[model samples]
Target: MQVRALARGVRMSPQKARLVVDAIRGRAAVEALAFLDTSPKAASEVVAKILRSALANAANNFSLNTDGMVVVTATADKGPTLPRRFRPRARGQAGVIEKKTTHITVVVSNDIEPTRRGYKRKPA
Candidate 1:
């Protein structure tokens, strides 16, 4: 059985969070935690917390062995953007500023093997 955890309205952009998520997907749970612990990206901190929650859910709720679990899927989705703020520009013009939010999900499973499809790079 796959166990998952979600964190909503995270104060980060989905694009930035995906950088960290893509790295940890398909890795062992313990290994993923280790990478997140040392990652410099701000998103890693949030992802780590959600990963821990998923492990806890598996162990406590589903009675699964977390030591053997692997990160099946880790993803970040764009969330509702906050109200737009405007800053005065050079000639009385307003500059729009958008504060983006994201929703992060991490799924771990001991029974299922993690598979990642390789992306092909186009010739320049």
Candidate 2:
């Protein structure tokens, strides 16, 4: 079973968010949360919240074992830029500033064995 959570319009660049997400990919829920808690990057906190949400979703919706779940995929994408204007140096001159935004997604899934079909085992 799998569950996903998203954090949209986060006030961080997608590139920075991607770095944090990469660190936690394939890590178990508890370990990932721990790592995020101590991480020095600002983006870590945002990603951690989304991860926690995903864990809660799994537990509440799927009733899955939290300990057995790992971060299957985590990604960050660029969101709409917020435009701002500012005056710098010369009079009557204006500069445009673009505040970046990011959309982060985290997926948590439990380990499950794949089933094989059309085969029967013989009794010993």
Candidate 3:
């Protein structure tokens, strides 16, 4: 089973969020949480919350074992930009500033297949 969590319009830029997400992909739930905890980036806190939410969704909604689940995929997308204008002291020169936002999605999965045994012909 798979569970997804999303955070929209986060203050961080998509580029920054993507760097944090790249570090935790394909990692176990506990390990990912730990990585996020020690990460120096501000976006890690937001991503951590989303990860925890995803884990809870997987456990509560899908009734999946949390230990077997992993962060299968994580993505950060650009959101709406806030534009602002500021004037400098040079002959009434104005500059445009853009405050970017990001949308992050995390998916956790617990659907590993069990390996088959070769010597299983004893008796029914």
Candidate 4:
């Protein structure tokens, strides 16, 4: 069975969060947690928390065996942008500042086998 957890309006940009999420995709839940623990990226902390929540959901809500769970899908999608703010610019001008947000979703499953897809190289 598959279990999923979502965190919306995260204060980080989707691009930044995607880097961390992509690394943990198709990895074992426990291993992904370990990777997040030592990761230096700021987004890792938030992703880790969401991963833990997914694991908990699997174990508690679905009564699944989390020991064999794999991270089936992990994604960070763009969220609603907050109101634009103006920052003082040169010559009394104002610069528009956009506050971006992200929505993160993590899915874990105990029955699916994880596979790693390698990058394809083109001939020179």
Candidate 5:
């Protein structure tokens, strides 16, 4: 079974978060958490926070085993942008300062029973 959790309105750009999410895709949940812990990117912390939430959802809601779960899917989507601020420039000109946000979602799955291509096998 698969379980997912979403963290919306994260105060970071989607492009930045995507880089962090890529490292953890298709990896075990525990290992992913460890990588996030030592990663130096700015987005690593935010990705770690969301991954933890997803892990909690998998455990508490679906009764999945934490040790057996894998990160099936992780995505960082562009979210709503706040009003752009302006910085004063030469000759009374103003520069646009855009602040981007991201929405992150992670899905974890544990194969309680082995099946071919996620399909249920019928007895012969």
Candidate 6:
């Protein structure tokens, strides 16, 4: 069984958030929460919130026990960027200032095995 939670248009850039998500991947749900709690990065808090949401979903909606759940998939994908702004630089040059955003998703599951890359199927 699996449950997913998404945090869209998060203020942080995808590249930065990816670091935190990668760390928590394939970890038990409780362990992931602990690591996120102690992490200093701004992204950790957002990821942790989403993780908790997933846990609640598993418990309330599906009536599943989340004690042994694992983070099956945790990803941070680039979201739409806001309008670009310009900052005046030396020599009267305008420097482009981009405000990036990201869409984060986390899937927690139990009793499932992740598939391998380049997977091939055999006839039953």
- Whole-model lDDT per candidate: 0.89, 0.82, 0.83, 0.88, 0.82, 0.87
lDDT of 5 at 57: 89
Per-model TM values vs. the true structure: 0.87, 0.82, 0.83, 0.87, 0.82, 0.85
Worst 10 residues of 6 by lDDT: 113-122
* Residue-by-residue lDDT tens digits, candidate 6, 1-124: 7799999999899999999998888777898899999999999999999999999999999999988778888999999888688999999999888899999999988765323321122233
Backbone steric clashes in candidate 4, count: 0
lDDT string for model 3 (44-118, tens) is 999999999999998888878898767877899999999866656577877777899999999877664221211
Summarize candidate 2's per-residue lDDT along 45-109 as a digit string, tens digits. Answer: 99999999999999888888788777877899999999876646577777778899999999887
Off by over 4 Å in 6: 89-93, 113-124
Q: Which residue pairs clash within candidate 2?
A: none
Q: Roughly what TM-score does model 6 have, to 2 decimal places? A: 0.85
- Per-residue CA lDDT of model 4 for 1-124, tens digit only, reads 7899999999999999999999999888888899999999999999999999999998888778889888888999999998688999999999889999999999988777655641222234
Clashes of 6: 0
For TM-score, candidate 3 versus 5, the one ahead is: 3
Residue-by-residue lDDT tens digits, candidate 1, 6-123: 9999989999999999999888889889999999999999999999999999999988889878888899999999977899899889988889999999988886554444222223
Clashes of each: 0, 0, 0, 0, 0, 0
Q: What are the clashing pairs of model 4?
A: none
Error of 3 at 99 (Å): 0.9
Error of 3 at 22 (Å): 0.6
Candidate 1 segments exceeding 4 Å error? 114-124
Q: Is candidate 2 or candidate 3 better by TM-score?
A: 3
Total clashes, candidate 2? Answer: 0
